[model samples]
Target: MARALPLFGLVLLASGGLMGCGERTAARAALSPPDRAEYMGIETQLLDASTVSFIVRMRGARDRSDVVAYARCAAAQYTVIRGYSFAQHVRTNVRRSGEIWEGDGGFVISPDLPAGRRNLDAEVIVDDCREQGIPTV
Candidate 1:
């Protein structure tokens, strides 16, 4: 009976460990290295002068984040090309069909860094994009 009790406790512990590690599993997944995303192309539209729209597409994304990153890279390069130092993200819509991912992002380009958590420094983001092997438009 003593040996049987220990075995039962071991079984309970093993089962509990499996069911209680959901958050740990999610954290591990979040920390996993990014997959290689293939840059397809970027289309730029002038919503106005300071406001610009970027349509970016790619493949091999792990999720919608890759598409959003592609759009961010495009927006950064576009801001720099327009002689702006910063861009504030307005909105981004991401969609995935099959293996392809598409992101439509709108930004307000400014000579100075905009006041927002979502504001992006054009030069810094462009550099990051380059380092990450992400193309910009």
Candidate 2:
């Protein structure tokens, strides 16, 4: 019985780890990096009810012409969006073709970020984008 219990525990841990890994892979797949820079429109709307809204539009990097996909704000950094502080989540929507990923709102915009592009945790950011209909890179 003791041996069986240990084996079961090991199996449980393994399965949990595998599940986490799967989630990471799926998130990465959704936000696979683009070959070239992509231009995404960012709009921050202050809701009348004291909540802020976000709108993201994706378009070709070279063309400042029109938008391709639209994403509405579903979530925020839980702090910055609320005007609590500046060093909070600063997420943006990234998209290539139909693929999408949500940039993490918590990351500070580095000068190296391509024009408007940001660096973020791929998995968490992508998942948030997917859930909120945001785009991904």
Candidate 3:
């Protein structure tokens, strides 16, 4: 019984160490972008003078909704950066591979909000994202 106790204690210690390692990994991933193997970032393409497309990529445990939100935030910021006041969402495509999620959102930016599309004000969208604690670029 004495020998068994020491062996059991050693096993517990090893398991605790392994569990802590996983916690540290999860905490680090939550705090910052994932490593290159599982990188998260955004890319933008200019489709025309008024239209643009944004792609947001995320890896590991992130939801599809989060990916779409990030893309929307990017579109809003991009509209402001391009000297536009409003953006209209045209379309979006989402895909997932293994642990990575990618969302592509297309927007048409205009100085004035258009008549019949799903329009968003650049400043208002960005502000809403900020209030919601969502990151933008």
Q: Please name the candidate that would achieve the greatest TM-score relative to the true structure.
A: 1
User: In model 2, what are the clashing residue pairs, if there are any?
Assistant: 89-105, 89-106, 90-105, 91-105, 94-136, 95-136, 100-136, 101-135, 101-136
**Which parts of model 1 have CA positions greater than 4 angstroms off?**
1-34
Looking at model 3, report the run of 10 residues with the lowest lDDT sum. Answer: 2-11
Q: Sort the predicted structures by lDDT, highest score first.
A: 1, 3, 2
TM-score of every prediction relative to native? 0.74, 0.31, 0.66
Question: Model 3 over residues 1-137: C-alpha lDDT tens digits?
Answer: 22221211222342454446566556334433323324377798998899899988877525564566667778888888888888887777889998788889998999996875366777776765565455567
Pairs that collide in candidate 1 are: none
Residue-pair clashes, model 1: 0
Ranking by TM-score: 1, 3, 2
Estimate, for each residue in 67-134, the C-alpha lDDT of model 1 and write its tens digit. 77778789989999988888888888998899888889999999986776567777777766776677
RMSD of each: 14.8, 14.7, 17.2
lDDT of 2 by residue, 47-123 (tens): 44333345544433332111211221223232223433211124344444544333312233221222222222223
In model 1, state the lDDT of residue 116.
63
Candidate 1 — what's its lDDT? Answer: 0.73
| Candidate lDDT (C-alpha), each | 0.73, 0.34, 0.66
